[model samples]
Target: MENIAGTKSSLSWAVHISVAALVLIWLFPTVGLFVSSFRTADQIATSGWWKAAFPSEQNLTLRTDPPSTQVQKGGQWVIEGNLFGDKRGATISVYGTSSREISTYKAGETGKFRNGATITVQPNGDYVASSDTKWKGGRGPRVFVTAVTPPEFTLRNYQMVLFDPANREGMARAFFNTLTVTIPATVIPILVAAFAAYALAWMDFPGRALLVAAVVGLLVVPLQLALIPLLSLHNDIGIGKGYLGVWLAHTGFGLPLAIYLLRNYMVGLPRDIIENARVDGATEFQIFTKIILPLSFPALASFAIFQFLWTWNDLLVALVFLIDSTGETTVMTKQIVELLGTRGGNWEILATSAFVSIAVPLMVFFAMQKYLVRGLLAGSVK
Candidate 1:
């Protein structure tokens, strides 16, 4: 009884720990980015996102009156100014005479360092600093002050990414290009492979094992190995460097896996149902259209997810094939890479682009995830 109780407690502890860690791991960066996306460029550069969550202190520089600019009024050189110009409600905590370190006192207090050098900075961007000791000076002491900043966030980055014309050459065009490649590349393989899978799965033929083995073998052969040769083949066939060439390449590359997966799922289907359709005077095409197709929805949807995602995110093949005589045929992945080269410091652009690129995949996953898992498990159980 004690052992069982201990095990239950241990399991509960493990679950709690796992959930806490996962929540932190997922939320930490997302929260940081959420905070950072709203902050000013300077704020982002100077402090971490966590630091931005609380009020932050900033070191500021204020000009002091030179002896030349100072008027000898009441037997003392005096100057008046306020550091925060018309900006209200800034808390000034301390003042320093040098730029190296700004804080020398807290709010409503004076620094011993500034002793005999009374410097006053008001919230309304005016200041008056004077020295009690007689002034004979070339340069007055440089004044430093610390000010508090409040929380801030903005949707400017999204606006700049979506609506800005300058972004067109980048994500906007690449988005369209990705869709162009992804749609055709996805459609061609599914259409061709569906027929091929139906043939391989249901139709009787000689050398069927050998053909299936060849298709399966192609799966293990890395597509990278055939890059140059396939490019050469395209060139030889006069399909060089265009959307059609790219579409064909993706279809060819995506075909073997598609055919294999679909065949496995299709073949597992009850042979009796297929034979009954045949016995009822249906041709192979009619059987596939009526019976096989309905049963194969899960497999087809799963393959569609795979193809759409692969084609959408592909960089290398797109580089080799769709990369152009015209520079217009660039995809999202390629554009993101190029932006990293040119706009390295633009975090807003980088984050927004990344989010935009993944947005479709997220939608696709949510939409077809059920079928993907179901199709994958189809043949395994039976």
Candidate 2:
């Protein structure tokens, strides 16, 4: 008994450790991207997002105000300004007159120039340069600074991604375009598939088994097989390539699985409730709309999520059926690929774009995860 209890405790600990490890593995990249999205391009390039929460020590080359900006202050010529320009939180640990001696003077200490001038820089980046004689340089003198910059984050990446008109890779239009594609594609299939599934499952019909079997077979058919044929058909029918073509194509491809899942779920509903509804003079359509539809919420939500994510992230379908040379209707997935080609080295932009693209799907999944889980489990049992 004692040995068995010890073994059980060991297994329980092992399971917990394994689960914890899996959670960390899944969250690591997600957390990294979320953090990177808030950072500026320079900061993202200089350091990892994991290190974003702490101050960073950096060597910076900067300059003071030029001779043209020098002013007469108490009979001395002086150039005074803030080096960091509204970025007031940085602390200059040390600085120097030359690059070779970057950390020669501590923050706030004045360093004498070769021309009998002295410059003092505070921790907050405020600087004052004064000379007993008139200043002579055409440009400002170079100042090398070693500063402890506070952790920085910005919404500029998001702004550029979402709102900047000059940004060709902006997700604003693509996000809406994706929504335009997804909403109809997701909804139309549910309504059509639910009616068909109800007919195949509950309502008696000739060749019902054969039709269900056909839908099941379609589940195994590769979408690639239908792409060329479907596109040709769409073109021939004058629909061409646009939101309508894409929506119809998504609905067609998604219906088989939707029908299969819903048929199985609907068939498993208690026959007594459906029979009694019919006995109370409920028509087939009425029974479906008023009774089966309400009880089949889990299945509907599950397939809605599946189709929404599928159509939202579909690059091939969008490329083949929807997008054209006009480029007005590019979706998020296509926009991300465009970013890969145009801003490949720009990790901040890429990270933020990628994060924005996925954020909606993640929210949808989390919101409907309970229904999705129940639908899967219930569908499998029946």
Q: What lDDT tens digits, residue by residue, belong to model 1 across residues 1-382?
A: 5476456664787888999999999889866765666666656766787897677777666555555766667866676644554545556666666566566555445443335667665543356666666656686566677777665567777677656887664477778888999999998898899899888888889988888889888877788987899889989999988899999999999998889888998989998998898899999889988888889888998888888888988999999988875678888888888888988887667767766787798788888888766656742323
Give per-residue CA lDDT, model 2, range 1-382, as digits (tens): 5476456664788888999999999999899999999998867877788999998777788888788999999999999998876667778988998867888888899997766689999988889999898887698888888887889989999999999999877899999999999999999999999999999999887898999889888987899998999999999999999999999999999998899999998988999999998899999989999999999988999888888889988999999999999999889999899889988999989999999999999998898888777656744423
Candidate 1 displacement at residue 345 in angstroms:
2.6
Q: What is the alpha-carbon lDDT of model 2 when measured against the actual structure?
A: 0.89
TM-score of 1: 0.76
* Candidate 2 segments whose C-alpha is farther than 4 A from its true place: 1-8, 66-68, 72-77, 94-124, 130-144, 279-281, 378-382
Best by lDDT: 2
Instruction: Report the lDDT of model 2 for residue 377.
Output: 72
Clashing pairs in 2: none
